[model samples]
Target: MGSSRWIRPEIYPLFAATGVAVGICIAQLVRNITGNPEVRVTKENRAAGILENFDEGRKYRENPVRKFVRGRAPEIMPSINDFFSKPDL
Candidate 1:
C-alpha cells in the first residue's frame, strides 16, 4: 500500500534532519530581520550611571507580581531523593 511505503522507519531520520534544517533557516531569517545590530545611546542614557541602568533594566525585566513570585520556590512535587534519604522510624 502507498501509506505503508511512506511509513518506513529508514525515512524518519531524513524527515527529522530536513525539519531541523528548515527550522534553523527560518529562525535565522527571522532574527536577521528583527534583531538589533547596535545599541543606541541617547543623551539621557549617556547621563545615567551604572546603578540607574541596573534599576531600569530590572524594572523592564519583570513586573511587581513576577518579582514577588520569583522569591518563593515552587513545591509542585516533593523531591524523590530527599524522601528516600530520611531515616525511617
Candidate 2:
C-alpha cells in the first residue's frame, strides 16, 4: 500500500536516468565507429584536429615512471607534432 506508492516515484527517475546514460553511451559508440572525430592520429597527412587535446593529460603524470607506465608511451603514442616533424618519413 504505502510501499507501492513510494516505489513508483523512485523507480521512474531511476529508469529515466538509466535510459539517458544508455543513450549517451550509444551515441559516443556510434561517433567513434564512424570516425567523425578520429580519436587517434594514425597518419601524418590524414588530419591534425584529432590529436590537439591528446597531451592535455601531461600535467597529471609529471613523474617519468608514471608517464611511461600509464600505457601512453612515446613510441606507442608519438606526439601530434612528431607526425610532421620527422624528416625520415
Q: Please provide TM-scores, in order, for all candidate models, with all chains considered together.
A: 0.38, 0.32
User: TM-score of model 1 relative to the true fold?
Assistant: 0.38
Per-model lDDT: 0.64, 0.63
Clashes of each: 0, 0
lDDT of 2 by residue, 9-83 (tens): 659989999999999999767756554444454665365553554354353235456655776544755776687
lDDT of 1 by residue, 1-89 (tens): 78997789999999999999999999767654444222335657445544435554555456566888795667545477558767777
Q: What lDDT does candidate 1 reach at residue 17?
A: 100
